[model samples]
Target: MTGARTADPPYLASLRAGYDRAFEATVVATPPEGVVLSQSLFYPVGGGQEADHGTLVTPDGIRVAVVDVRRMSGAVVHRLEKGGLVRFRIGMTVRGEIDWARRYTHMRLHTAQHLLSALAFDRYGLRTSEAAMSGHGGYLDLEGMLDGEEPIRRLEEEANSRYFTQPVQVESAMVSRAEFEAMPGRSSAKSLPQGISSVRLVLIEGIDRCPCGGTHVLSTGEVGRVRVFRDPKGKVASTRLSFELLEEREGPSSPP
Candidate 1:
């Protein structure tokens, strides 16, 4: 994908809290399908993760549905829904926002992914190849093959234990690729984009650490219980482990 959070250019603001923050951004470029923004809180489709969907509204309240967000040459491109091509203009300033529920769901799942990847490597010496998430569930593709439901069951057990069981905090930081390489962690199946010399590393207190760019919850407990699917057939050349979140139904979780 686009490396990790460290890969973010200095000109753009951190999307860590973009869903709650409103910013005025000028349109930098407009193709037939989408427009590039000066800065974006929307997580684009990268690292096997899906792009965010949302709306862009003018200061006058004129709004357009943003169907997709993609990254091209370091810029975040917002693709509008069908019709309304003229709703935006190159130089026009608008308020860019993302679907909060979708973004937060991804945040939770992505963090869980980091946990899963770390567990696989720590317990089985397998490194993650690729991953993608939706809603409260997603899958992790690793380099090795897995057999039987027992392995997956063990994953569920370790994941729940390794994840937030005692209210530990989650953290993100930018580090050069050299530091990323030196540190102990799981590496994704895909390499970071060319020319990227830095990475954003996500850390879970007492659990695991890895480089990632997707949004994530502040606390590990908010990630809830990680449940893995019990199917050996899902394994191909690479083992594809699927997992979902069983969020605590009690109340809202505090941000880390």
Candidate 2:
């Protein structure tokens, strides 16, 4: 199968493929105790840290816990847990399983961060230069020097307004260089990957156009509820916007 970066595109978890039988895979190479799977739905840890967690089920009815998922030279490598090694092997077809519950939650939270960042940039013109995902939460570093409570509160309001209105739509597409360029206020050339032949553009309709290699939902509504845990006393001008997606709530009782 063509190495469709499609898996990493935002909204893939909400994608039908996630619920389908194992997607597609090819035997890459055999390691000491496990096998390397090519074209895996598993997202190996990249950018900073936090590896993807899941399990790999073998044809022999044995399951190996995917302790660590990482990347090297464009290939995703899964390290199996001890005592679960025999179940997996090179040249053997196995089912790649992900903790959808955990993975989906991450997708929702991650997308929420993007939306919040876009809001800050749009309303306050904050210029963010770096970001990283940690276990506690994710944070972005902006160049803007800020010091006050009002600014933080303002950012919260802007994000909640569009969020509640359900205006954001996270969609993906594989477009040519020209098509990618047509989007308004698109990331400039200096930000783009060098020698890029084709690009995958993830559009946050009406807000931002980002070249992202991560899973996301079809629409902003799927994000359920968002909690912006902004830290006003953040050490310098840099603001730390920690957030999480609230679990879906049950419907209330209907009137008699």
Candidate 3:
């Protein structure tokens, strides 16, 4: 399949009410054979994890198989099987639906990661590197060593604290491409692209303001509970931090 193209929609942030408007959308671009769904909720694999897996539907009421999804040039692209592609054209609208089970898992894990980033900064004055959301779980690379279990446990506790304290809010703003390039911490970043009018910033209540293109839960509490799993390699210089979602009862909290 060809490289994915950036779509105007932001799957991670654009989600508000589920199934707001399901309709037929035509393929705006010349997609590869057997492809469907010009726009989708499937998040292409990036950051260190695999892409999303789901199905697609054609305008003629045909079901196309979405074998994989990926991100390209700020747009999310869906790759289909051989038979999935048809003689699609621009302005052709195809109905799109994501695997909610998989998407929700990713949402929870991604949000948990931000909370983990906040925990690292809040407790030990550490910063995160190389964060990823996966099917089984999620992981965030740390610049500092694990030191010990105490720090990890403490970070987990703080992450939960932030999750329950307030609602999570994410907003996007358009800035001059030059201004975006000059933003603090934008230079050292590895995953982000330079020079763009729109920047998607994620804020976890009183937590953080980092650029991200990943999907997240509407509220931090929606992440449920999180537990950090430490890698046994246990290299103090660098370590992989993983997390698992725990089911929790929702208390009365306002969503942002």
**Residue-by-residue lDDT tens digits, candidate 3, 1-256:** 3553444454544545221223344564554433434565566776554666666665667766667876655456677777555535556667776665666677667777877876776676667767776664777777787676888887777677756335566433445445555765412344467544566665556666566766666677667667787866534576778887766443223323
Q: What is the lDDT ranking, best to worst? A: 1, 3, 2
Q: What 10-residue stretch in candidate 1 is worst by lDDT?
A: 3-12
Off by more than 4 A, model 1: 1-21, 162-165, 188-190, 230-237, 248-256
Evaluated with TM-score, which candidate comes out highest? 1
The alpha-carbon RMSD values of the candidates against the true structure, listed in the order shown, are 4.4, 5.6, 4.5
**Which regions of candidate 3 are displaced past 4 Å?**
1-6, 10-23, 30-38, 48-50, 72-76, 86-92, 164-191, 233-236, 248-256
Ranking by TM-score: 1, 2, 3
lDDT of each: 0.70, 0.59, 0.61
The numbered model that scores best in lDDT is 1
Per-residue lDDT tens digits for candidate 1, residues 174-248, read: 788777767755664246666779777777777677777777666767678878874354456788888887773
Please provide, for model 2 over 101-192, each residue's C-alpha lDDT reduced to its tens digit, 9 standing for 90 to 100. 55555555556666766776777777556555654357766557545667766776666666733646676667677767675552554566
Per-model TM-score, in order, reads 0.84, 0.78, 0.76
